[model samples]
Target: MKLQDILTPDCTICAVPAASKKRILEFLSSLAAEKLVNHDTFQLLESLVKRERMGSTGIGNGIAIPHGRLINATKPIAVLITTEQAINFDAIDHRPVDIFIALFVPEEECQNHLCTLQSIATIFRDKQFCKQVRQCKSNHELFQLIQQAS
Candidate 1:
């Protein structure tokens, strides 16, 4: 699927000041909650936290794709956040992470969730795309960059 298919303009954040992984997930959970119905923000955060406890989603090169499956979710949801400064995320490369793309998917849609994660990883793996995303000055620009990259 497409990034735009799951990401909404309202969920795109630029220059966020989240200093820790917990705070980042909290912010993303709240953002994803806007598009969900009958889902608690704490529950969403718990799902993401649980996944992170299993392993860090930080895929190196200043990017982190944190995702979790939710039983209450009817469809996939994405939230993109670009922090004002890089934060330590226990990344495999031991590099700070400044770009985050979070996904919340239905528990039953494992294949689709994996595909979406792969697509996002592929997009961010492009050095040019990462550079463009880093240069984005606003949420609109960041969202547009994702569109262009896709």
Candidate 2:
């Protein structure tokens, strides 16, 4: 699946003031919860947190792909965020992260999950694309940048 398939303009946030990794996850969870009917914010936070316990999703280059599986989810949902300042996320490269892309997928779709993650990673690997994402000053511009990506 493509990012546009799961991500909406409303789910993309820019210049967020979250100061810590936990707070970033909380913000993402709450944003995602707004779009997910009947989903609990606490439960969504738990899912993302549970995955982080296994390993940091912080993939370095100031980016983190925090994702989780939801048993009750019917389709994947993605939330993109750009922080006003970088925060420690336990990245492999040991650098702070400022860009976050949180994903929630149906628990049963393992293959789809992997594919989606791979797609996101591939896009993020482009330094120019990431630079543009970081340069965006508003939510609409950020969402447009992601949607217009190749």
Off by over 4 Å in 1: none
lDDT of 1 by residue, 35-125 (tens): 8896888988998999999999999999999999999678999999999999999999999999999999999999999889999998888
TM-score of each: 0.97, 0.98
Give the clash count for model 2.
0
**Candidate 1 vs. true structure, TM-score:** 0.97
* For model 1, the run of ten residues with the poorest summed lDDT: 141-150
Q: Give all candidate RMSDs, comma-separated.
A: 0.8, 0.6
The lDDT of model 1 is 0.90
Q: Candidate 2: which stretches are off by over 4 Å? A: none
Global local distance difference test of model 2: 0.94
